[model samples]
Target: MGVFRIGFFNIFIYLCCAFLYSVPNVCGHNNMCFDCIDLEGCKAPKHFLKYMSAVDRDKVVLRLPTDKPDPMMDRCLNTGYTIKATLNGTVCSGSSDGLCHAIGEATTNFTITYSHCGDCYIACDCYSQENGNARKEGPIILTMCLAAFYTLIQ
Candidate 1:
C-alpha cells in the first residue's frame, strides 16, 4: 500500500510540473512590448501589476520598474508622475495629482515628468484578450493547484 502511495505521489508531482511547463509566460523578461503602450525595468516581469493601491490603499510605495518611452506612443492613461525611479528595494514618498496614480493590473503605468507625460489623461483601459487580465492568472492558478495537491497528499 505504501509503495503504491509513493508511486502515485511521484506521478502526481511529475504531471504537475509538466502542466506548468506547458503554459508559456512572457514574464521571464523585464519589459512588456505592447504595440500602443510600452514599459520596462519591472523587477517582476511576470507579475506586472496594473493596480496596487486598490489591493493595498495607503500603499504610497509600489515595487515596480520605471517606464521606457517610445516616439510613436501617443496617449496616457495615468501620466504626469512627479518622480519616477526603479524601486530596487528602495522606498519613495510624494504627492500625486489627479492624473498621477498607481492603477493597473500587471505592471505600473506611471508618468515621469510634465514634459512627456502631463496631468489629466485617460484611456489606459484597453486590454487584449491575450494580455489583459492574464497577468493575474499565473499566481492564482499555481496557488489553486498547490492547494488541491496538498489536500490530495493529506
Candidate 2:
C-alpha cells in the first residue's frame, strides 16, 4: 500500500511538472490571430476569407493553409468570439479587445459581428507557424520522460 501511494504521488507530480513546462511564455505583443468571422450566419475560416475577399477584393488575396491545419492549432469557432489562456491552474477566456476576462468559456451557440483579426495581410496561420512552436518540443520531451519513468516503475 505504501509503495502504491508513493508511485501515485510521483505520477501526479510528474503530470503537474509536465503541464507547467508545456505552457509557452506568451511574451511579446499580444499577437493578432483569426478567431473566425461572421458570414452568412456562419463562423469559420472559409467565411472569414470570403468576407475579406469582398471587403478588400482589390488589395489582398486569401487562401487556406497549404497543409492540413495542425490539431494543435489554437484558433477555432465559438460563440461571441473568444480567446483563451492559462493561469496558475485555471483556464481563462476573454474577448479580443481585452485581457483574460471573466466572460466565461465560449460555446458553439455564441454570436459575434466580427472577431477583429483583420488588421494584417499576413494571416493568422502564418503568424502561428512563426511563433506557435514555442512549446512544440515540450510535448515530445514530456512523452520521452513519461516513457522512461514508466519503465523504471515497471
Candidate 3:
C-alpha cells in the first residue's frame, strides 16, 4: 500500500510538470495585432490587407478586398494595430476587459469584431478561447489521470 501511494504521488507530480510545460505553448501571446510584412519589405501594397491577430498558436490572418478602392490600405500602411474581443455582446477592451482575456480565462465564446490599425477595422469571425490546446488538453489530462488511478488501484 505504501509503495502504491508513493507511485501515485510520483504520477501526480509528473502530470503537474507536464501540464506546466504544455501551458506556455498553448496560451501563446494574446491581444496583439500587427501589420503584414515580408522578407523584402511591407506587403500592404499587394492589394490584399493582411492583418494577423496574435491570440492562440495558429495566427488568424485577415485578407481584405482590393476591388473598388479601399481606404483601409492607407490607414494600415505604416501604423500599429489594436484588437478587441467581444463577449456576450459586450465590447471587450482595456476599459471593459483586456482584448484577449476580456471577461476571464474561461470565457471562450467571443468574436473579434474590432481589429483596427489606424482608422481601418478588419472584420473577423467568432473566436473561442477553447480554440487553443487548452481545451483539448483538459480531456487528455483527465483521461491520463484516470488511467493512472485505475492502474494503481488494480
Candidate 4:
C-alpha cells in the first residue's frame, strides 16, 4: 500500500512540473497585438520592432508602412535609434543597439535587440531588415528535486 501511494504521488508531481514549464510557450508565435509601446509611439524614421512578452517565447514583429511621410525623421536621425520594451506599462528594457533580457516571476523573459543601421533620415533610413523567427525546444529538466516534486504531487 505504501509503495503504491508513493508511486501515485510521484506521477502527480511529474505531470505538474511538465505543465508549468510548457505553459509559457503555448501563446502562439503569429499572434499580433497592436498599439504596443514599441510600435505605437515610436518616432524613428525606420525602425524594426520585435518583442518577446514574458508570457510568450516567440518574438512579435511589428512592421510599419514607409510610404507615409514622418515629421519625426529629424529626431530619429539625430538620435540614431532607440529600442524599448514594457510590461503592464512599465519599462523593462531600452537600448540603442544590443540585447536586453528581462526575467519576470512569471516563468519567462522578454528580450529585444536592435541592430545594423546607416544614415537615419526618413529617405535614408536603414535597419536590419530580416524576418523574425521563433523556435521552441522541449522544456528544460535539470533537477531531481523538480522531478520528485512533479511525481510526488501526482
Candidate 5:
C-alpha cells in the first residue's frame, strides 16, 4: 500500500511540471493593435477614412499595463523597450527586452503567457508601422474593393 501511494505522488508531480511548462510566452505572440495611447480619443489618418473603424475592446483580451513600470527589460545589456502587462487586476508597464513578467504577491514573478498567466497587450509600435491595423470586419465594400484591385494587378 505504501509503495502505491509513493508512485501516485510521483505521477502527480510529473503532471504538474508538464502543465507549468506548456504555457505560451505572450510577448512573442503575433497580435497587434492601434498604436495610439488613447483609444477613445485617437483618430486614424484620413487617407482612407473609409478604412478606419472603431477599436474593438472585445479583441483586447490583455490590458496593456501602460501605467506602471515595464517588467521585461534585459538586465544583461541594460537595454529595454517599454511594454505593458496586467497583474491582479492592476495595469503595470515598464521597460522590457521584448519579454515581460508579472510580479505578484510575496515577490512571485509569473512569466507572461498567452491567455493564462497574465494579460498581454500589443500596440501599433510593437508591429513597427503607423496605425495600419484595421479590423477585418470593417466596411466590407472598401475591403472588397481593395481585394479586387490587388487581384486585377496580379
Candidate 6:
C-alpha cells in the first residue's frame, strides 16, 4: 500500500510539473500581423503595415489599391519591404510585403516564420503555417497528463 501511494504521489508531482510548464503556452495569446495605412507624406494619422508572422503573410497578398480612384492607395500599400525574424534576430529577405519565410526550426517546438517587417505594432493577424498546431498542442498535452495523473491517484 505504501509503495502504491508513493508511486501515485510521484505521478501526481510529475503531472503537476508538466501542467505548470504547458499552461503558459496554452493560455498565451496568439500572434498577429497587421497592415496599417501609409503614414508617409500625409498629415493623416500614422497608419503602418504590421506583420506578425510568416503564416499570416501567406494569407494576404500585397497589392496596389485600384478599387477606388485614390492615388494614395498605391503609395500606402506598395512600400517594398523585408521581413526579419525576431526569434534568431536574423533578416530573412527583402521580398515584397506579406511574404512568409522560414527562419528556424526547433525539435520540440514548431518552425517559426517571420514576415519581412520587424516587430509589429498595432492591429495584425497571427501567422502559423501548421494551422495553429503549436498553440493547440500545449493544452492537449497538459490535459492528457492531468488525466493520467488523476487516474493513478484514484
Best by TM-score: 6
Q: What tens-digit string does per-residue lDDT give for candidate 3 at 37-113?
A: 11112122222223232342123223334323223222332222222221122211221111211111222233332
Clashes of 4: 11
Least accurate 10 contiguous residues by lDDT in model 1:
114-123
What ranking emerges by lDDT with the best candidate at the front? 6, 2, 3, 1, 5, 4
Candidate 4 lDDT by residue in tens digits, 12-68 = 999999988665445321111221222222233233332233432222223234333
Model 4 weakest lDDT span, ten residues long: 114-123
The C-alpha stretches of model 3 lying farther than 4 A from their native spots are: 30-38, 43-154
Clashes of each: 9, 1, 0, 11, 9, 12
What TM-score would each prediction reach against the true structure? 0.19, 0.24, 0.26, 0.25, 0.23, 0.26
Tell me how candidate 5 scores on lDDT. Answer: 0.31
Off by over 4 Å in 2: 1-53, 59-118, 121-126
Q: How close to the true structure is residue 136 of candidate 5, measured as C-alpha lDDT? A: 40
lDDT of 2 by residue, 28-118 (tens): 1121333433111222232232222232232111223443332222232122332233111112122223222111122343231132322
Backbone clashes (count) for model 3: 0
Range of the 10 consecutive residues with the lowest summed lDDT in candidate 6: 36-45
Question: Model 4: C-alpha RMSD to truth?
Answer: 26.7
Q: Residue 56, candidate 6: how far off, in angstroms?
A: 5.2
Candidate 6 structure quality by residue, lDDT tens digits, 1-154 = 9999999999999999998876534432122222322211112122243334445354223433433322322232334332221223221221233432222211233222222232321122224433468888999999999999999999
Alpha carbon deviation, residue 85, candidate 2 (Å): 39
Q: What's the residue-level lDDT of 146 in candidate 2?
A: 100
Q: TM-score ranking from best to worst? A: 6, 3, 4, 2, 5, 1
Better of 4 and 5 by lDDT: 5
Model 3: worst 10 consecutive residues (lDDT sum): 95-104
Tens digits of per-residue lDDT for model 5, 4-122: 99999999999998866543223322222212232222222211111011332122233334533323322201132222221222122222222222211122233322321123223
All-Cα superposition RMSD per candidate: 25.6, 26.7, 26.8, 26.7, 15.2, 27.6
Which is the winner by TM-score between candidate 1 and candidate 4? 4
lDDT agreement of model 1 with the native: 0.32
